[model samples]
Target: MHGEFWQLDNKNPDAKLYYKDHCIDYNELEAQVQQAVNSLPSERCLIALVAQSTLDFVIFYLAALRQSHVVLLIDAALAENDRNELLEHYQVNLLIEGNKIHSLSDYTHQLADELCLLLSTSGSTGSPKLVKLSKANLVANCSSINQFLPIIKDDVVMTFLPLSYSFGLSILHTHLAMGANIVLQSDSPMSADFWHNFEHYKVTSFYGVPLSYQLLNRLGLEKMPLGNVRYMAQAGGKLLARDWQLLSDYTHNNNIDFFVMYGQTEATARIAYLPAEYFSRQIGFIGKEIPGVELQLLDSEGERVEQFDSQGELCVRGSNIFGGYSETLVELSYFENIPLLHTGDIAIQSPSGLYQIVGRSKRICKIAGRRINLDELQSWLDALCQFEVVCVGSEDEIVVYSEQPIEAEVIKQLATKLKCHSRLIQTIVLEAIPRLSNSKVDYHALKQ
Candidate 1:
């Protein structure tokens, strides 16, 4: 009754995990993980994971890795066809689903050089890039992040997002490293059980995307019984001025730390985070480099720019960076200490020694004769009405699309708001915009 992160501690018999009705000791979960691992065919195992952040998912994931099997993490929100295609393309010989793993303690192991985990990424070119990260990558990154964030043993964490995303993965790794408690709920965030679970479990921390905070602000969290969350971190995307303004005030008044983190899947989840103490004044900043990491900014000539408040392409060098991608035919390429990961993001170093993500270089377009950053424009649109607007370009003109098309009056209003010439911009309304497998808007596909 033991494996992976936590060994079975039947001797202690005192460690407990909370459930609505009863508490489960560490022995039960440890036994479950070991049994699951023993039952599976461990050699070269490539399987799809579909657990909903429940105790079952956590147990199965740890068990699979404990025995050194390759696992593919898929978001539950992914269309079934895309999920199937991902597995099929990799020619994964076995598949694992459901909360229950058929109990068996019989399995084989022959992996001293085989791959362990295949993580899919949306490459800069708008295609799926599969990176093969070993147990080493996951374990190392987890340990490093834990050093900076003093996550106490069994500290309560509320996980409201999908586990497949890299940001979510970091939460899993760090928690497991400290044997922390995760309060899992399978309902929508708006449900009564959602907040009740946090309060009941006595959650102290949580992570969210920018949209999550924006939505919470719109819903007005003044009356929500969140109990006491000691910290709330934001990642996945940028939080604009409107949401940041209210969130900063709320967290400050509540005496809670608000962490603003930034990273990519390439870095195994996170590379930087802003300490909660620095907020309100410079809301978009993503703070300093995470522990065991260094950052630099380079232009087209690949020279470092050292001046404060200067903009350039951001680069990161860190141990958390994942190893190279796995090939379909089979050949392993390991990652070394690469000096830079040229993030396509445009960033600026502030006077007070902080980093702020201004916009993505890929999203900038020339509207008429002037260069306009789409992300910057979108921020203006959000302030006006919280509308999600994406701007793309043609050879000579720029096209802006939104779910609810803005009226002629709205366009004029936006022009006044953004200080842009009205005639040069074209606005259209569409029922939907196509996104990639990873849920990022497919600007390249939109190119005609």
Candidate 2:
């Protein structure tokens, strides 16, 4: 089961996985995986795997991989309609959840032998599109990540994000690729038991998204005695500069490294990351591209942007870039002919040679004939106040929804900064911003 990473660990089969009170060694895990593989169908076909971070999930996923079956990883908590749509769209023949394997519709289309993994675009917005990742793509991504992070064999990681998420899946992949131990927890961070387990297991590292950091800030992470943690990472979505600075300061004072990474499902997992040494100077920058990947900014006309601080669509080229999206069984065999992926993200090249995101191309709006980026506005609001804001409206009006009330002065300041009339900006108070299951702001839901 170790494949390439566990070559020397065959004799040292110590506890490799810790879930609740049970411990599974490497030898036992391999045996269980083989047992699970024996029961899986031998024929090649696509299978839907509703993933949960459990011992069985690990075993079944590895078994399916070993059997050369393409696995479409879906969230177990997905709604039935969405689940059915995915099953029908992909023409998946097997549904593996927990101990049960239900046969679904038969798929006759020939899938590429290299295609081994399928994951929805993170924060999919209730779309049926799924990104098909090949085995080589996964291996290239893991190798590139290891080149910078240098995952230690004895590193113990505390799982928080769901395995269905790309960032979460990368955590599991990189750790396993380095022959590291994993501490699986199927509980929310809000629960007291979760922290107790974190302490009990002495987790050496942690990974989370922006929302996770906000919750940690609310809980006062500075007061918590997490001395055993060697490092922490932030990804999935952009964190406010203020919030990131807070965590960076805390981590620095405690002699722990903090990494700010940027990635997409199309690129398998990671693309660029800010090194710990330049964390302070780079502040909100996404830093340089990872090993084996090239990143550049391309203007709307397909020309590269050479001016610093000039916004353009971020583009990535690498072996990790996935083949293409699969919306139906026929598209499953489609391979990406385009060499460069134009990420919809709008970013700029800093004077220090780092990449800083400005906004998303799809999130931009023309307010009163003047282009306004909602993401940029949200970032400014995030730095100005503690409230969470989501900007949404048409070309005539810009509506801002906040978790807390906003003062008139703040609105006026925003209008002034945006070069728009005060009346054009409307503010609404909401208890919370609508978010997808993966913790990304659900703009579609917000509009509704």
Candidate 3:
């Protein structure tokens, strides 16, 4: 199966893409993809897949891959300015409007490795960086996932997240690689009848972020019968201990498996997935390395730390790992021959074969002449107020944002926990945290 889901069972009528009442079969999908691919100008140097949940989006994505044209997936929900800025950043050659495969005959030929995907970062620090992922990177990562999660023909996955994200791209690529069925939901999840699609479609698996977990909790998933659901994965931002514990308990109470995983845009999509079986026992850990991957912690000198509980930069080495970025190859500096993706995230390994995310070294700051991890402070603040919080740096001071009005005494207590004085603390109360389209805290916009 070198390409195009060579093993798809075309005869199955129930092989429908259950987007609400409409059922798009594998045969129809193949036809649509082929037709769309054939219709492309072929001259277009860069093709952008910019739709959300339409059949056109799915077909175009596969079509772009098959056509071997560098495809740039644009988020349909992105602000016009942001989208334009991204296109400018990547120098996109062509734009494909939603639901319409408008001919682009301006580009006469494909340039070598032009720009596959201009993936937008969370823009936590500033503007979202366009991580240019290539077709080679996509193919390698999709192949790598097959080593861990067997992409059997029987497998079915639901696209619950936005098509703009890397995880969403992975879902499309990996499932297509596995010849698995992809069930696209037409209705927005905000609608009351969203869960109906899940049930009606007989969705086998799902993936989402921390907010999705919070939403499920708020939606009251106590009695829903998800009969065909097999597994679910969560990543993106750092999942709180309380949230992770709740999910772990939920999966245990039921027989459903939950995979708490970790990765970044630099590594294609996923670098590690905590096995669902280990969910109950590990609880808060991000799990061992994924298949064909080596997860190691390197000291300041880039030497592997042997002792348990030793904190170091979480480095990843594997075939799924990308070579470099699109515009420039920022060769990851290392002290040894080991070429590891030096994830700025700091972690401490337990003897039990579990890795606990401590905090990012970049986020650590000096407050009141003492080093403090903002993540640590945020966790402590959340514990005190029993609500979500994020800590960011402003000059020499630390600013805290919370969902509800937090008492100054509580912040003083956090100072005590950090062994610091209260005068160095500043707290901001918000009714709710503002999130990016991808559900991450919009730090850049928040700074305004």
Candidate 4:
């Protein structure tokens, strides 16, 4: 399952992974992974891994791939009940965490030899539905990303997002595939230590979600001493237009590449990227498809939409498209023969031939017989206030959860702006928004 990256003659033997002060070379890392693989019972068994961005997780992940095992990557911070439920649902044979190995089930899911990875549809909320990714899916996506970003032996990326997340895992996959090193840190991106090590290690690039960029903006990106930082990438969610412009301006002024990427777990990692050269010009665009992917927009009735600025669901057909989802061992046999992926994102093709996300297909609700886009509502609230908020609702009412205390006037303003009855709006103040390990708001927890 693991490709032949070890055979590259140009791979720098001195180039190694940076975990704090520890540096592990490729030869040593390969040996460690081999030893771990040798100790495993057999290949092709489903292994559920509670992965943290640590050396242990990296080694074991490589080992599982080397053996062609289907490794389900789960967030290390998941609750025991949620974790065990996943193990049971998938009929996983082994559970690995650091040095501990616990055999979970006697049964093994006979998956296709091509299937090498499983990722949750939802972030750390533990949605039972799992996306089955083949080695071809991984290799194709990784190669496409490398063609654009062009990672080399000298490049060093900082680890911010959890390894369980597809985007996060792609950072590991692409960098390691190209023999570039990664500087791992278990601390928050806002932490003083994260920046300390970022500068200390001369990390060339770092990836972020909207929230991470928001925090960085508040911390004064222009003020930070990041002379060695070469590029900055934003994905996982749409960064607010204002914030995106701010970051882009700073990067441009400082001669740093800013990439706005779009992707989902179903496609392994990346689908499209707004290149650095288009950062200022292509304001709200997701840019063009990555090297091997073809993108299209389809209307609700499933017909292809070719008219410019007409909104429809974004569809992608590529070698990187994954196998069908798995809820049980039997479901593992299901593979998507059609490589097409309906991304469930409502997008419009701009006149310039770039796609812009307007909303999500599932992010709408009926309120008093009128459709309301919750994401649009959230974006409206975002533009109006500095508070972190999530909007969820039923057919008749809407609940807005604010991470900080908000004035009653703010609720009334939102209701007026959204043209909804103020009485139908309810607000809840939380110390912090309930978020998954990947920094996405946990809607499941919010509903609870």
Highest lDDT scorer: 4
Ranking by TM-score: 2, 4, 3, 1
Judging by TM-score, tell me the better candidate of 3 and 4: 4
What's each prediction's TM-score? 0.85, 0.95, 0.88, 0.93
Residue-level lDDT tens digits of model 2 in 4-72? 332224534554888777788777878888888898998887888878888878878888887888899
| Tens digits of per-residue lDDT for model 1, 148-184 | 5657665777776667767776786676656667666
Sorted by lDDT (best first), the order is 4, 2, 3, 1
Q: What is the lDDT of candidate 3?
A: 0.69
Q: Residue 389, candidate 4: how far off, in angstroms?
A: 2.9
How far off is residue 432 in model 3, in Å? 2.2
Model 2 RMSD vs true structure? 2.1
Instruction: Count residue pairs with overlapping backbones in model 2.
Output: 0
| Candidate 1, superposed: residue stretches over 4 Å from native | 1-23, 99-115, 122-128, 331-339, 384-388, 403-410, 413-423, 429-448
Clashes of 3: 0
The model with the greater lDDT, 2 or 3, is 2
lDDT of 4 by residue, 283-398 (tens): 87888899899999999899999999999999999988888887777878667665589998999998888888888889898876778888878878876776567889788789
Tens-digit lDDT track of model 3 for 198-308: 776577776778888777665655755467777777888767767777777777776778887788877778888777788877855787787667889999898998899
Identify the leading candidate in terms of TM-score.
2
